[model samples]
Target chain A: MAHVISMLPVRNEAARWLRATLEQLSILTDRIVVFDDASADDTADFCKSYPKVRYYRGDIPWFEQNEAELRRHLWELATYENPEWILALDADELFEERATLELPWLLNQEDYDAVAFRIFDFWKGTEQVRIDGAWNPWNRFSPLLVRYDSTLSPDWMAQPIHCGRFPLSYRDRVTFYSHLRVQHFGWARGDEHLKKYLFYRERDLAVYGAVQSHTESVLSSSITLEPWIPMPSPGWFSEKEHR
Target chain B: MKKRIAILTSNHFEPSGARQVYGGAERYGVELTKLLLDMDCDVEWWQVGDNWNKEIIPGVPIRGVPETETPYQTMPHLNQVFFEQAVDADGAIYFVMYLAYPTVFPNSISISHGIYWDHPGMDKFLPSALDRQEWHRRLQLAIGGVRSVVSVDTATINWVRATWPILAQKFSYVPNFVDLNSFYPQNKESRSPHPRLRVVFPRRATTVRGINEAGKTALWLTESHTDLEFHFVGRAHDDNMERTLTTWASSHDRIFYYWLPPHLMAELYRFSDIVWIPTKSSEGTSLSCLEAMASGCAVITTAVGGLCDLIQDGYSGLLIEPTARALADATKRLASDPQLRERLGTHAREVAETFSLDRWHSRWSEVITRVF
Candidate 1:
């Protein structure tokens, strides 16, 4: 059987959805690299309890203070497993069940060096219910899975706010878009969402030299989360459900 | 007294040249400048470009930011200029939120071109979240000083009001115009009399303009019909799209590509039996529909934003949803009927003439005078 590893660089993700998510991930990948960035919460102790998970903590604060550094360190630690492929996901992100099966086959294929998937960013409290201009006016294609090359990785920067840039060279030609989707639940908690936006506003001013929006301005226009069940597009997700 | 106003843009607005999809707001600046000049108003131009017309409205001044090798230098210069001119001009008009100017001018107005990176659904289309935030923040700076927020279409007006409640009552509608004299009809008989139908796409070769959709239609038609010819007039937005299109065009003999200046476009329309404008919702009224109609070609478009206001299916032009396969079906329908194409082209020209530069000036002249 091909070896697959899951790499997660986390800061303050505690008792939310981490436990249940890990249980699901363990079914597909044997080893899980959980890089803890000196969290004030009991995230490190909780993650250490999992059998298939390898939790590591940095000495100084890095996740909130310096995201790029945390990601670089996570990438470095994921390399030690020498796995066939790495599924790098954020603490708040989860794979659609179909992606769990489709990923193994996609990582086995030689046509692509990296794999991207449609990201169903749940607005407020709902899932992929509203796609076409119904919820947040945004839907995205993001790189969630990468073929493991022991020698190569994304170059890290000190103050990169948005996930550090991926290489454009191989991304243009060799990237394959998978039928699976990623369910993002970051905007579910109000405190978490507000903190992230405020941190981003300050960081943007430091890096870009201009930012005029207040946190309340975004909140005023934000979509109210609906209690709708996830209605993912009919693809591999539906095919698996029929079985 | 004539109202003195200034407009800011990122793309250099050439006074005269080959016309491309500069859209409603960009062209509105020049037209308003002309109309203001006719009303004896002083209109100046400020933007970052190589060619800055020193005398935009005879005595009115103009300035372009000297090409900064890096964006770092450009923003500082813009901030300096904005600070200096914030209280000076009678009014100002910013094309979009991404233009990075003051949000509010007591007498000034801002125009909404379409969705920007910061807009809720634009994560995939734009560069990054940081870029979107920067644009969002910059847009907030001038919200207080501007008198009204203007958009080219009603849908966008509704969208802006709903999205930015701060600018709720400020949003207004101003449809884009097509110069009838410049893009006047060619003798329909002068076109190739062969049974083959010639289709023209007057758009910048970008995904936003539905190039992939156009490609789908072109590829299918090339395989299915020997009686259809496709002509792509505008250049690609990026090198990747350019290379992809160049390779694609090379494979098909039925496809003809032209990336000439806008000055050559008036005559260029004479060769088309139909012009396809299947673009995304990011546009106000498609200038392509009006221009194609004025050039005496039937327009087949999608009801994205402003195009809905312009096209009356079976009358002025054909309308469909924004999809590649749908566009292919529409093209096939137009190809099969020449008289319908002729009738639509004629009525489309009439529609284009109604929304001429003259009508735009007369309609906005009072509003411009009242605002300033």
Candidate 2:
């Protein structure tokens, strides 16, 4: 028997949405671990009511700091819980009926480390969702299930709004699974919340760029550029090495 | 017998509420004209910058008149040429708020967009350096001889009706409406992906119209409530405001800002838990506030201008007198109480359904049919 664990990274969320997420967690997953990146509201305390949920507290200095730390901690927690499969998620994302049942089966498949599920975005309200009824073109990917033994872990590139990486990092080592659906709740009228996320994103990019350049300059001066007196061009270096 | 209605505006699209677009009167002109067209009457649109006699709809004609050589001084004269051209028609619905042109015809109906009054600077919010005596004089001259008058709301009509009480008596409140079919609430999942308290503030960076206490309240809320995310939409008016906000946002990870398209803005209302727009002064009925309410967002706003008409305290949404403290307190109230947010959001959406496009078009059709 394979152990399954779900993880959600959340900041501040609407109450109804939070309640929905909790409901989904109770039914589908064995253990739900949520990393509260020092949320400003009762999100932390609220998650505490559920016994199956494990909440980790972390201080977020900036947007990037929060995302990076959350991913790292989620990996650590998932690894420690030692679930055979880790279903990574955000507070608003949920598994569709098909994916909820098929997720375990897909993860257990031989040589599969991570699985990407198709995310149906209910762009319109409850009425539209009912009318359009499952086949809308707007659905994308939701990466809630990942094998712990896989090489995939948290990295800097997996930071912003969409932290999932594609092209299935290991084409040869891992097998691809499809037809599974994960429902994404990102597009709801909560775009006002998105503005706040963008603000931090802009700042995060600026700081990340500045730090990257600063590090490159420091590294080049001490190691790469300083050692080469004349600092020969590419052609010269290639010629010398070949000769 | 179809009436040919002429609407004077700068653009066909009025995306946001308040004075951002064709100003209040110009938008009112557009709304009135659209209403007439919906009633199956022949309508024509006249914009300042558009080409003359462009076809907007088949029988419904639209025209644009470019400003004259000396833009500031010659616009009124150019508008006069257009006005003269329009005089031969059966009747004209003119949004002549500024001193663009004098509608000499007895049949012209002037809708008041704004007033220059004694100090034009007060209305324009210009620096003390520029002399606005001419602006004020020209505005007074424009209103001096109009036969029929219209205003967007009671406050604006009241301001004008003090001078022309007869016209004020003739004043009718024709509110703006959003097409619910085009702009409705998003599904529950997209609106609130996680259970984080979503606080949305959709105001431009203008000091007069924007959430003045956003920066302070955001910082305070971010520090106190980590689970709450604050979203500030619309563009900043200047470099100073942008820089100030950027600096303020540097302190917290939760504070997020985004520049979005109108469709995306509609989507935001779905996701946001609470939509906050606290304006100090100069507000007509806010399309943004109405849109948010329609899209199922619990709203907190100041009782300014037409917002009073839309936001009913303890029912649809919360209305507080404009202040940082009031804004913060209202936000805190919604943030702490999930039940209140859900209840208010549910009611707000129901109330928004009443102001649909069909209702707006019907009301406007009456004004147009009257011209016949």
Candidate 3:
């Protein structure tokens, strides 16, 4: 069996839904690697309580200044385990229940090296996902699970923000977009939305001269939300294994 | 001694840096450079860039000139700059015809890819009647100034002949070519049967290439037929356009979007069963269409620009107007009828043989012998 490892980055996520996130990840991943970005709270203690998780803390905060560096550090720590596949996720994101059943067959396939899934951003409540403007992550595919190749050197983007979790070099490899969904609960509450908006205004204003439209759209009153619906299982999942 | 030649164009690499551009024009430049090298000529390419120099291909140095913009068109200024810079070369080749406008050098040739002003939206660029007339006057001067004008299709030659009868003598109709060995039908015995019929649109994601129309048609066809798959295999001009196409493809299970370089395109064409070339305007003998035809894929193209010269309605391939409805109807017809696809694909391969790279090299050599 191939080992599936999950690498997560955290910052003051103990007060948030970190426990629920870890519980969900425990069902799908063989081991969970958590990197705390010098959180002020006891997020390190909370994460270390889980038996599957291996915790590490940064000496100094680096998420706001440079995201690519933080992700590279986490990647180096995750690769030390010699995992077959690495799933990069955040502290607030969780794969739906169906992923536990569908991912085994996907990982066993030899054709594709990376798997991209549709991400849903839950807004205001946990039952609904945002669909208006750029909040609609279901419109695009995001590659979360990648087969770790030791021979190729991974190159990270130099940007301070919006730098992807996986190396940009994985784009040239064959990627399969699976019909799986990852639910994000970062914006599920009202207070956290305000804090996120303020954080962007502080960090992103220096990088981008003007406020990004997607950032502004998050606070718009005329937002649209759709109920969360799990995708049906693929036909191959039910077929009998010949071997 | 080898003949020294200078080639001038607007862009060989992306303006941002030294990245090689991927499109029909860039492919033509590569093929032309190879032909020139085979004829024992020393060639160099010059384009608008940030004064950086690099090699486009081995032994072919691509020099960049700092770009300048004017209130009017910037190409004429770039042309003068290139002419002044390459004054000592034996001859020059204007990769784009309009770049030679209002300027001329001795022993020079110009190439017209196709008519670019055929689209309805061109009125916004040249708004008045006098503006349109002045545009024609500039084109006339450009054609008269060059020693020879090599056009990729007869549509451009016919348009020039109707506009200025005297300049018709200078025009040479040399349509684009494809390598038959690289792009050919996959053998029937080796072919693996799949459930879904793969249809491909192998052009850039641009308005003039009719990506919007093809995208709309793809949505309709995928919704109507469950056993059909649509693949878009080309790059977009910008990140936003690429994102839009990616989003659309992601929303549908049977649709896919990706890009490949020129060498890998042959394999993709062979994998595809049907090819769509729904060009709205501003097209030459599109290299994608030629490659797809050579790969023995049943092509459905609009009768726009040089596409009219390549595909015959109901014979070589299905020809129709540039519209989403027309594209959808043709795709639906080709999807249900496999025999029609095989017959059209067979005829398309036969037609493609007439436009092989060997013939193109010979024709270009004849023209080069006369001018250089």
Candidate 4:
């Protein structure tokens, strides 16, 4: 059994994003599998730059089968790696520098089979910019981090778009931490981001045969812990300025 | 002679800024769907999701492509199966451009919710680096197959006709009309206490809507005139607007900025003496202007785009050029003249009767019937 680790799935993305993902994960895991899902641009070539990166052409024959194939690919990776744990992410998702450095120690623990990390989704380049306030707390996505051999069952027809489906028995073995967060870099500048979004949105509609509303997908589903609370920019605004 | 009328939308009650899915569009759509149901016409509002509860609107049937939560990136994939579900509608209006929506259907009519000029230098003011040119190209290409173009204002119709002359032949003009009964003078809280000569600005806090210029004009009005109160409405939660207004408000006691619920907005108009709009960008006839006018408020709007059609300079209300000095002077003059305010307010309210809800419903119903 190979102790293989997979780096989620990706499509057309800039080389810089790929660089950030690789650099963040270099110290934590040795086995790196990169799934290339028919990128129109040079995303596949960019992934090949890293020596340890294992690239696979997405098995979906047409755009309609993209989602099924993507979900199945993750299952396949889990079965093949059979490692202690499996880390899943999109191309835009990045492991923060602090979390990346500390991941090895966290993974070595025996109590938690799947580890959950706090994710601070900064508006991509807002970290260096002074124009906007601190990152928005309302914009966060959470998914399960499980052991490689875990049997995961997903209910694809429900909420939490990507992570709507999870194994019922694996609930008690998972743990979430606040110190480490997945830095999702999906929202960048320009039409390139919109192009990717539009492409994925269209692909989703084609496969599913309808528009899945965000309100139902996020707010009304079983996955929602509570009603969406309007949280102010936690770190950006002072208590006085919050009102 | 029952007909199928479909209103294409991404979803209802979402935060999208499109007129159909947001604000008055949803109300208008609901009203239109109800009207069609009464007429025994088959009406369906289609989108990608299943958030729309069947019992939300009684009697009117709502259909969706599917309740899909797939992680596919493109929009066409979501509705590839649902596009087969389109009934032969007498008329169909694509409210906002979802990828491949217009192209998916066979024979139908599309109404222009708004036009994107794709102004080459629009990015100079807009913060987003998204290619306006490409957005415009795709928008124009998508609507190319529509049977005819229906624009709410002459400016949008003229711009599209002139920019793409080939498509001009199919242009139809239908001014935006408001429900007079829903927005007319109500026995709401008695008009705002005119403790001081009240000046209200109800536009978005963006450069596109000329909020900066309006702010500068407000500053000039307050500095030059002592007995005036300035009120700014709409999206006060915006960070940039908050920052700018906070600094300005500290020095000026009379200037107030805050957002009010839409229902309460009618009360703001009922009490205000004058409504000032100093917008620099494109505006499909503003519903706010019509509402203010119907509630008997003198409107001081710039002579740009649809505002020109609404305000007849010195007659209905002042039509000043889009400038800080010009708007400031106009406000000052309106502040001094109580008689002019009363006259303009009365005329403004009277003229608004033409665009009342009954009139608009009749006009829209006529379109649906013709197509059927």
Q: Lowest summed lDDT over 10 consecutive residues: which window, candidate 1 chain A?
A: A230-239
Clashes of each: 19, 41, 0, 30
Q: Kindly indicate the candidate among 1 and 4 with the higher lDDT.
A: 1
- Misplaced by over 4 Å in model 3 are A1-243, B18-20, B68-74
Residues A1-243 of candidate 3 have per-residue lDDT tens digits of 579999999999998889988997887788999999999998988998899999999879999889999998899899998999999989889887756665665676454577777688998888888877777764566889998987767778878888899777665344555546789898999777888997787666877877888887767889988777544432223321221
Q: Pick the candidate with the highest DockQ.
A: 3
DockQ class, candidate 1: incorrect
In angstroms and one decimal each, the interface RMSD of every candidate reads: 22.3, 24.9, 10.7, 19.3
True interface contacts retained by model 1: 0.00
User: Residue by residue across B59-168, what tens digits does model 4's lDDT show?
Assistant: 45444454444222124544454455654666565655333342645445556544434333455533354554555565566557656555666776677777887877
Expressed between 0 and 1, the share of native interface contacts present in candidate 2 is 0.00
Candidate 4, number of clashes: 30
Give each model a TM-score: 0.51, 0.50, 0.65, 0.51
lDDT of 2 at A6: 80
Sorted into a CAPRI-style docking class, model 2 comes out as incorrect
Write down the C-alpha DockQ for each prediction.
0.01, 0.01, 0.05, 0.01
The CA root-mean-square deviation of candidate 4, after full C-alpha superposition on the true structure, stands at 19.1
Off by over 4 Å in 2: A1-243, B1-4, B10-75, B85-90, B99-101, B112-148, B183-192, B236-252
